[model samples]
Target chain A: MSVTTIAPPANPVERFLRTDRMPHIWCPGCGIGTTVNCFTRALIDAKIDLDHLAIVSGIGCSGRVAGYVRLDSFHTTHGRAIPFATGLKLANPKLQVVVYSGDGDLAAIGGNHLIHAARRNVDLKVICVNNLIYAMTGGQTAPTTPGQVVTSTNPYGTFDTSFNLPHLVEAAGAVYVARWTTYHVRQLSRAIAEIFQKPGFSFIEIISPCPTLYQRRNKMGDGLDTMKYYKEKSKVKNGAPTSEVGLDKQGEIIVGKFVDRARPDYRELMVNQMHESLGSRFIDPVAAECEEGEPQGCEEGLCS
Target chain B: MNADPRGVLSGTHFLDGDHACCEGALAAGARFSAGYPITPSTEIVERFSSRIPTVGGTFIQMEDELAASIAIQGAVWGGAKAFTVTSGPGFSLMMEHIGYAVMTETPCVFIDVQRGGPSTGLPTLPAQSDMMQARWGSHGDYSLIALSPNSPQECFDLTITAFNLSERYRTPVMLMMDEVVGHMTEKVVIPEADKIEVEPRRHTKKSPAEFLPYEPAEDGVPEMVHAGEGFRFHVTGLTHDERGYPSMTPQTQDKLVRRLRSKIDGANRQIGLYEAEGLDDAEVVVVSYGITSRVAQRAIELARVRGIRVGKLRLITVWPFPEQLIRTLAKRVTAFVVPELNLGQVVLEIERSAGSHAHTISVPHAGGNVHRPEQILDAILEAAK
Candidate 1:
């Protein structure tokens, strides 16, 4: 029997994107572009209104994504995109807030915000591009950089151990946690599509290659070479542990969905709690006598 | 009693500096506060968190100082005057974002109730060591408006003034208090809130669609529109254009940086808020701020009774440095006595502002104890003789 392969529908959403800016700032072989492509595709696939979406990012090469996007964007201070995005989400819950940051941004300096947002299960999507080095700062050590990896700050070999991204997100109680590399473009795109559709704090850590920084220093050569390496090494698994996935100089890369569950979103919980506490305040009473009173500044309007 | 402008009730109440700062912020029309509790400043957050919810506002205890500072900025962008309070270590963490706020022209307030520092030096003790740091702690060459309140009442009053200055200039205003002022309790008369003059943030008269986030107006103050207002604006830490996009050209960078620096510096006359006591005929003047200013005031009074011609110049706004006032005061006073909890932080500014004409003395201390009035009085008598 003959089988037919279908192409992705001519993405009508490309009209909303700045295609001219592409082949974005990521190194040619870097996985960040694939992840970004997937994200843009997911936004298109979900049919989210570009005008109503706000992309917030912190300092790093990956953080620069906000600038290239054709939407309301905020390229904020280093390690602060998550909280800034959190404020944006809380201030206007109707706005779709997405945080795009690097491993050093979300895992190191911004670790506290990452974990707390997950714990609160804020209704936002966080796309953490894990390049395993401080790419923008000339390949310095990052929280996710593997032990003994050589970089600008740790030329003699880093003594620091790497963070297990999926485990950390799960431990932080994120409602959705997924892991994918740039090599698996279709799968990463699908994961993003599904994550964006689900509510609560959805976290996806994209294991991207930083050819100019991490790759060159580690003798990983150029971008295409790194992409080839990712394609050869990554295994798209669902529940595999980081410990089970060994990091070999030329070995397998573990990538896939790790956790997905239904959980109460932050805004919904906040509104529900408000109604419970302020009972009649939220709902009009049917058997109450009406009386004239001084005009009160609407409190509900303030939240928006 | 004078009619209050902010509607604060008239009543004498004993309150700590942290509580006073919170009250002051509320009276100033600050509808948002984001902060993480640290030594000496935790009470401010605790008080604000409970009070803000009742006043149709919001208070968030952010994960850390960086988050707190960014959250405050977000709140400001969400159309509410905002503030965050921290101390020593937290202040260090907030410096970068503070610089971002300055560059982006976001109007907000930061209350740094300084303890001994370098790194968490005597977290619960009073120290004026952050004075110079407050002026230049942020990474870039930018002007800042920082106020030092000497007492709980002033803490309440200056916090309101800090918000006003921040709004007027479209810059982050710092309220530099100390452990002494933060923790000390005193009788503060809560004037009818209406008696307090509140400065509403200047928003563009233009429709949100036409608002330019960083264009300077005639008075150097720009109008702001919050995010989600359908005004597509950008804010960045890098040197940015008038439209707020990052710019690499030297001329563009120069224009952006100069306007940011000059807006506050050129408005020094309006932003330089200070109190001068007995300056007309005094031979010796004590220049002090924060908790140290209280000691200076007492010292000046003591010196006057002792037949020493001593006066006081209390710096309400520490940055913009009150240079012109100090330079004018320098020409008349024989000597300047600077009493601070830190080892000569503000004294250096006083000396630089005083130039070679006046003899300047620094009465420096570094820990839990404060500079006693006698110590400053002795300096006054010595300078008088």
Candidate 2:
């Protein structure tokens, strides 16, 4: 018989990942990995400079993203990633900072930071992977957990109203907001790419599958079944009012670019106000002392 | 290294300890600060907010102390010297981030204008109750440098020293100021920037290929590469290896924790700073720090007039404890009288170091106010007997 020749599948995005840190802590059929794949693809599509990019994450399954990324990364303490990224972005305006974390991390313990960062319209790209449960800590109830879902903490079923994430952030003054499920990889990747072009606070919520804790406990079949359900239920309504986009248990999912508008980001507002007030004496703080050969040049290790 | 002259307010000025601390931070090349409004400490940030824009820096009033504490670390990694200011309640909120700073080896400063508190007990009053909390507040075994400033002048001078020590060691340094010193006004002479010696960050000369983020050099301190110069290094709060990647094994944890402590402990002599006076011939040696030290100075003078040979050991840097000096003095002195604004904090260290070589006496104060001179002199008189 003639010998059959086949080429190995190309994984071009491997350079963007810390392959040495793999196999990651993510379990089998977890949607976090899928979202990461889309993120890497978006970075490529956006042609973002990998050198000037930094990833910050808080405590959760998704917080491990910082450790697995082959870039300037920080795995900060619980709920503090947004403020940490805020400092990074404000300190070095040349660098693009991203805060990547989970539902419980971004919406529960970190909820205050989430709204405030958006309110400031800090130039940060925030990716919140909403798996509807605290998967890493054995499926505890998250602030975003849909109503009547059986979580570890809410075994009798969750009674409180869940957060409408897009609405919350949009109302808090985010410049761009979008929602997509893991089933919509192309759409998610495009949305992330669009975020790179936006100047102010941009947020993308990815509804992901947690097969081990969330799906297994809720008897929602397996990861594949969840994906099929997502494929069937999601309805794209671009620029739809974010107030009506709340998710519910076994309900229709509104998925699309819900909010995209313009507002001067934190830096822009700061620059304008300072320039207007100080006039001739105004100094661009971001470019101030760090440049080489300047009066306060930070190049010769002087900044510390 | 000389500081940037632009940040220096090079002249004598009447200022409070809080404002003086702010001027000191500017002169030390701190280009970024994040803080929340807190009693006694708010003036530092208030001055920084207005002063930073003109001096080419950024000062953000974060949502709370938790954000303010860690934001400074983020700025440090972004290639700027940064700090935060707070009091007891805010300092308590910052313990977790302080641990994060230790684990990541991010060099920064935390100025705690201390107030009385187990929990917000005295917001506007002076207290040194948080001294132990400064050393052991974060839930982990770690060592840090702490400086106690007794006056506005020391606030300016020691604030610069705090920044220098933090840079040299690559660890968080605490400028422990009680509300008395934080709010007290006095003449602060700010020297020219070129005259102010500042320690530069230990940036790695090695290329990205050769550099490992957590690799310690000959001095047991790692070289740093801030975010965005293409180093692409990683920093985490978890137990990590020299590569700065998390490794959860017990072996990694042991090695990391031991090194974090040993780095500062090995250089304790170089780090310990204090003023020893009249110890050559003395029966009772008084140990004190912060505002209480100033009060103790008066007590020593009074004790000397009362025919008791009293000596003073003023601790400028309190955390590394100056155990060598305490141990040496304990050998000859009849007793050690330790007075503090707190009930009994640093006195415990004196008791531990003296360990039957000398009598250890705790002149405790409940801490709504500074100790009266007679209160310490009474203790000194008792110790002499």
Candidate 3:
């Protein structure tokens, strides 16, 4: 069988995408590209109005995802994407705010934001790319780098325990929590699409490969070999215990959907609170004008 | 300050520094305040949270400083003048968002009631160590407008000023108050609403469809559009073009950085708000800001009575350091005395700006106790002789 080469579609979705700066600074065969593809596909699949989608990302290769998206995106400070996304979402609940970040960017430095957003169940989606190592700064040891892994910072091997992200998300009360690998493109894309469809705080952790950093140092070969490892290792069973999945020095990877549920979202709660506080005045023009000048009134002691 | 002839309003009352800042934000029309309570600054948040809702604004106790800062940013984008208050550790957490506000050109106010720290040192005590951090803490080469208040009245006045400058410049303005000013109680007259000049944001007259959020106008400040207004501009941490999309080209990066730097720097003349006392034909100048400046003013009087040539230069806007004024003073004065609560922070800026023309000395303290007027007077007398 031969694969047919067809001319690219005019007004290709990729054209609306940010592409002039590529080839991206990401390493060759980096999972970031696959994750980006999945995200764009998910966005397209959901048929979300692109004008109303706000993609926010923090510092890291994964953080660069926002820059490549066609929507109103914010590439914020290191480990600060969740909070930035939270602000974007709260400012205009009409917009879909999605956070694209790396494990270190989200779980490590931005750990507080992730847990709080989940606890509050803010109306946002966080697609965390867990490449295990901090790939952007030449593979420094990261919060997700498994025990005994060696990197530039952890030259003597990592003694620090790694974060179990899906469990953390689940524990933090994320309405949706799932894990998938770049190898499972269709599954990953589908997971992103589904998570985007849900309202509350949905979290999708993508277990991606860091070929240049994690692979080369850990002897996982190149990108193809890494994907193959993921292909062989990942268990498709739902709700499998994390302990059930293990890896040898050169072993199989594990990936699958973990959790899906529902809870009261932050936006709905905020609107309810606003209505209760304002009563019938909530819809009054005078109250609306008062809302506009309320800050000044508070300072003047009139409101206090 | 004299009370207005009109009877005190129902909600008006004599309050402390922290409460006054809250009042100032309210007066200047801050509709949202999101903050994680920290010492000295906590009262501001507590009072704001309780009072904001009554006024039809929102006060959110965010999970942390990071969230708090971002929440306020969201409120500002929602078309509300918003603010957050924190101290030391919380300020450190807010540094990243401060950079965000600068990059996105969002108008907001950050009140850092500074405390002693490398970590969480002296939460209750006063310290001005965050002054330098306020100027350049966020890992970028951008200019900011930071104001320090010397009294409770100034605290109230400057908090309102901070928001005004924020809206005027389309950048985050830092209210760098310390523990003393943040907690000290004093009488502050609540001015009539109409008497206060509240500057609404410089909204683009051009339709939202034609708006480029990051494009600088002739005044060097970019026009801002609220999120629901249908502007299609992007906001990013990366060096971006006028359209707000990431632009990696050297020329584009240069323009972005230059515009960010120049917006505040170019407006330095107008934004270099300060107060000078007794500087004409004086040989000794005592430079100070925030609460310590009050003590410095008293010290100047003592030195004057003692037959010493003494003057005072109080910095109102600290970030765009009043270098032009400092240079002129340095040429005329034999020495500059800088008295601050922190152990020699702003003194460094004073010394640098003074260059080789004047001898600069620091009267540093960590603020468990206030600097003595006699001590500063003695320094002035020595400098004069």
Q: Which ten residues in a row have the lowest lDDT in candidate 1 chain B?
A: B1-10
TM-scores of the models, in the order given: 0.88, 0.97, 0.87
The candidate 2 chain B region of ten consecutive residues with least summed lDDT is B319-328
Better of 1 and 2 by lDDT: 2
Best first by TM-score, ranked: 2, 1, 3
Cα lDDT computed for each candidate against the true fold: 0.79, 0.92, 0.80
- The candidate that wins on TM-score is 2
Model 1 lDDT tens row, B1-385: 2222332535788998989988888788776778898998899989886665445456777888989899888767756678899999999989988898888888899999989877968888888888787889888789989998988999898988898889888999999999989999999887776577777768788875576667889877778876655565667777767766666799988888888888888999888878887889989888888888777778888888888877778888889888888888899889998888888888888899899879998888875779878898888888888
Give the lDDT of residue A226 in candidate 1. 78
Kept native contacts, as fractions per model, are 0.31, 0.76, 0.37
lDDT of 1 by residue, A1-304 (tens): 9999999887655654546445566666677666767888888787776655788899999888877766677889888998888776765555678888889999898898989989889888889998888987788988888877888988998886678877887788898887887777888888888877888998888888888888888888887787788887788888776446534345677888778888888766765665577654542110110111311212334222
What does the i-RMS of model 3 come to? 3.6
Q: By DockQ, who's the top model here?
A: 2
Q: For model 3, name the residue pairs that clash.
A: A233-A253, A234-A253, A295-B26, A296-B26, A296-B29, A299-B23, A299-B26, A299-B27
